[model samples]
Target: MILQLKEVNGMEEGERTALLAIAMNLVIFGIKYVSASATGSIALKAEAFHTLADFVASLTVFTGLKIAKRKTKSFPYGLYKIENLMSVIISLVILYTGYEIILDVINTDLTELRNSGFAIFSLLIATFLTFWFSNYERKIGHKINSPILLADSSHIRIDVLSNLIVLLVVVASLFGFHFDKIAALIVVIFIVKTGIQILMDGIRVLLDASVDYETLSKVEKIILDTPQIIKLKTLTGRNSGRYKFIEADIVLKTHNLDRAHFIAERVERITKEEIKNIDQVQIHYEPLQKEEIIYVLPLTEDKTSISPHFGEAPCFMLVTFKSGTETASKTEILTNPYANIQKGKGILAAELIVKNMVDFVLVKNGFESKGPHYVFSDANIELV
Candidate 1:
């Protein structure tokens, strides 16, 4: 079930942070608007409008988080893109806030500041609150990997810087100098810069851009490390909101349909375990086609005679031949490195054979209920 606004304790971390930002912005907007009216400072009025924009942006983020959780019949994949859409809207709001500041700087006449002490004190309080909340919100945004929250946090950071500039102007007015218009123009630069960054990030996700290269590399390593996978045909990942969707095509060593499916499931499970925020993992697997067959036989110390004991054998002989023909095309003898091991010798020997890509094991007797038997069985290697 989706979390509702009424359930405060059960709400997602992103929703909680967004709601906090809305409340904080509202309070700051009131303080700035009061200070602007009392002092008649243009920069203070511009900051008041910017704080109001922040309030609207935070509301948009909260709404997006709520809607993104719903999975309708038309949107089987969920409305994850709503978060990115909200980010775009927030960016536009920030940009418009900057434009308004620029207009105020150009059109408003220079007015002597009144109640300078009150304006400076109020701006200091607003700046301190903005700085604290922006940092706190950003920490939660990264922890939950929420795109809208991160975008909103960045917008709040711009407020912190702008408030500081306006405070400096208010203090300078006490010295018979007024640079309120110049300070507001500087604040606009920061606002525009932040807006563009958020806009680009939102657009990329909305366009179905691939996930970062580092994440893709980590996934590739995980897939390649699986012993049953013969080759990885394709691997691709993309981001929807803050979650990742991964798809891969692989070739397995086993020809059995059930074994192929089992290997695919194992790969999917491991991939999800190793990666964070994975929404879905789709793995398409096929069996490897055999053009040649390899056989491994346990050998005695002399290397010429077959050993009846599979685990205690000192060496192993590998013979390779075309699938249809009986005559061997290549033969090699390999030392059994695990022959002297006191424990798990049979299992280690079986793993060595699997690593050599042996299709069959030639043995003198049955090895039922043995560790080696299960190992070879899992690899789909036949006993002859």
Candidate 2:
């Protein structure tokens, strides 16, 4: 039930963000177009067209989010790549807007500047709104882990800078200085830069590139932290739209098939808890091959013999021996850190052995009714 909630909430949040961006773009477009007509500034007109392009891109993002949610028997994995496709489309639109702005700068003459104060005031308002929306949308994008929303937010952020340049150009024209064409050219550069960045990101995801190193490292840590996991063979993750898909292979200390599966499920659950927007986790596990067995025995202060009490032992002896052999290949003595703990010492001792990856524990008697017994059982550590 909790997992279902996460999926539904993610989609709803992405859709809401896209819709908000569309509305903001519409408002900014009207403001910029009105101001451009009033002041006859070429830069202002270019900005108006850029805002229009943003509107189209926002609409594209909304459509993509809607379509990405649909699942069919023909496409069981969902149309998640549609979000990446929308990002690509948005990049193309941005590139076209930049090209149009460049052409306007070269071909159009700045008309007589009028209502200079009104133009500056209107641009100031538009820039403020764009700045606010960009930050807000970016925050939400990261929260929901939506690629399209993040792309749109980046597109809108560039608009804020372009609006400022246009405003400055309008102000300069009032003082009998002309920089409209130069300002429009600068805005074109920003638009093109942002467009290229978004294009690369979309292409990488579409090609099934590996997820960021930071995320993969976190997943590796999670898998390694599981007590029963002896080795993490491979871990791979990729982004599909706003969600992440993961695959991992691991070796568990237990030879029992059911125990291996249980450990895998535990890993999956913990991974989902720590990471956001995980779509699926596929884990493949195999039992450890018994070449050598590591046995831990709770020992007395002298470390020469086993202690009758498991948790109250002052130290422990670790013996490693090859399978079917009686002689020990290696032996080491370790001081029990939790021996002095007044309470829960048994459970802590069990955890200590699990953390050391000991295959078996030699006990004087069965700890069937103790806390340590359950801990050892859960970790799949055999008792001898």
Candidate 3:
């Protein structure tokens, strides 16, 4: 289907973005590291470590995607949760780096920082690359709906802002204004905030928290709008990394067991069509309980004559009995779709009757019983 192809394309795009992010993060890290060592600016050093954290986050995204795509039959649900687990690991790494940066600010001698024009050039480069890359990766992340890429993008966004503050510190030192440690402390706060945010999101996915309320509402609306589904009993949905899965139970206002199944199938199809991100949908249906005896009769067009043939009949007349007495009746002259088929007519007709939820089939006296008779017998459809 076109939809399936689009999904694959989106996934490929996410992978490509992750690779790009790793390269950019590494470049930023190297540039910042050089400046930090040359001038001994605490902010520059913290920014270097933040870039390193971003690099690791990018690697985590790549590894998670590779593992998630290798799902096997033993794990039919796939390995999507691996992405969330990797996110958690990435967040903890960032948190540790953040604490280190905070401690460095608290313990290091701030008065020893050396002012240098070359450090400003390096910081400028770091700032521009991080700001541009963050926006680029964020656009890609949204395009593919990838949580890993989005998480990594968030990390890079903080990198851009922190790099700006580091640049300011370098500029201020050149103007006889020295508050490098204070600026570095500001960067640490931003880094820690981003880490906590990513950590909470990862933990939520690992715990199987329910999806957003808007998505849940949309799901409920889709099921309720299905024609034969009279009522929805229950609905539960959860996220798996960037994807979603839903399980539902519904009540159908139909006495026929076969029609109930077909309705449920329609609901599942419609739900998937309406919502593209849902990777799995499980639907359970119950038929309406009513005291009725239903019978199906093969008839000629206009209901004027009996058709000895079952599969070739132009239409069928449905009759219903209640309390062992006639309650309601209807005759439908629907086209027999299998009439022109050369083979499998009997099976198709049997399936049609089952879909109608017929209890009995009235046949003309001399009707043959090779194909349809056997089919009806297997389905417990009495022929008389």
Candidate 4:
């Protein structure tokens, strides 16, 4: 099952990144707030609020990590959508703060942060730290394939750009140009743009849109390279947190229904192996047009059980359904190769049956799942 796919320590790594961001934001917040107070600069004050927003955004990402991994009775699928929800929350905060900065700048008396050496020095240090932190988180985000981490890092980059704008306000003030209001407006505009991008990213995931084009194309290529696939009917994917969920419909080249199912299983396994962070994949398949085939069964030594246990059966009994009826025309017995497998008896039995092109295996207890059932179903074989 694709749901079984996992990356070791992915969540741990994401939480570490988010926590680091939180610490960075706090450090920058104190530095910039002091800088804003000393210089009487509206632009620097806006940067302080921007850092505060970063702090909140970091908390949201950390919370998303916690919720994404948890599944409860009321939330059996886990809380992965919390990532999108957190992103939207972060975006709105950024947007609202940016608007506040714009109005504050437009109304404030235009002046350069005069003789504010400590303020400029502090802003520079915060800028360099924000830049480094954003870069670090971005690298880790890509490594873990964490959308929330990536989005949060982008949000931090907005801080870096805002710092640069504040520096521009300082330079313009020295020249008596007094472009502080205009420079702060530019920084707010950049913040709003980053917020919009973050919002779109979250909305796309919330809407269950198809996954990234590159990944979707990779999945398509892998399926086409599979040996027995006749036609790819549909290949679709979506995301929740760091994981991708895929569903595909395929047609098999073989006329035998059993053969078609075998192909679907192969596709599922290979795709999951090649693609990291795929938490689930469901395959719907069809066989190429073909003639009707035999009805297969398992039998005991005495051939007395129409309901013989497949694991203990000594031989297989093949029969044909009477035309347009549930009745069998006759029974023919063949040796069972997997009656005494040391391990994986069901799997070995299923493989043997599929190789012989058997259509069905009947069992009194219904069917064993995973190994044998997965095998049988993959080959379009059935148990009754």
Give per-model TM-scores: 0.91, 0.93, 0.75, 0.72
Tens digit of per-residue lDDT, candidate 4, span 1-384:
334434547788888888888898999999999888888888888888878988988998999987788889998767787887788888888898898898888688865465667877897899899999999999998988888888888888888888888887776666666666777888888988999998998898898988999999999999876635547899899998778889998877466666666667777788888888877778998765534456666776887775346766788777876546777766778787777867777777777777655665777676665687887776566677
Question: What C-alpha lDDT values do all the predictions have?
Answer: 0.89, 0.90, 0.80, 0.79
- In lDDT terms, how accurate is model 1? 0.89
Please tell me which model should have the higher lDDT, number 1 or number 3: 1
Looking at model 2, the pairs that clash are none
Evaluated at residue 327, the lDDT of candidate 4 is 72
Model 1: per-residue Cα lDDT over 1-384, one tens digit each: 122232223237778888899999999999999999999999999999999999999999999999987789999988888999999999999999999999998899999999999998898899999999999988887777788888999999998888888988988999988999999999999999999999999999999999999888888898887777778999998888877899999988877788788888887787777776677889998888988999999999998778988988999999999989999999999899998989999899988888898999999877998999988887778898
Sort by lDDT, best first: what order? 2, 1, 3, 4
Report model 4's TM-score to 2 decimal places.
Answer: 0.72
Candidate order by TM-score, decreasing, is 2, 1, 3, 4
- Compared with the true structure, the alpha-carbon lDDT of candidate 2 equals 0.90
Could you give candidate 2's per-residue lDDT for residues 221-312 as a string of tens digits? 99987778879999999989988899999988888887788788888898899988777889999888878888999998887688999999
Between candidates 1 and 3, which one is better according to TM-score? Answer: 1
Cα error, residue 32 of model 1, in Å, equals 0.6
Best by the TM-score measure: 2
lDDT of 3 at 338: 85
- What's every prediction's RMSD, in angstroms? 3.2, 2.1, 8.5, 10.4
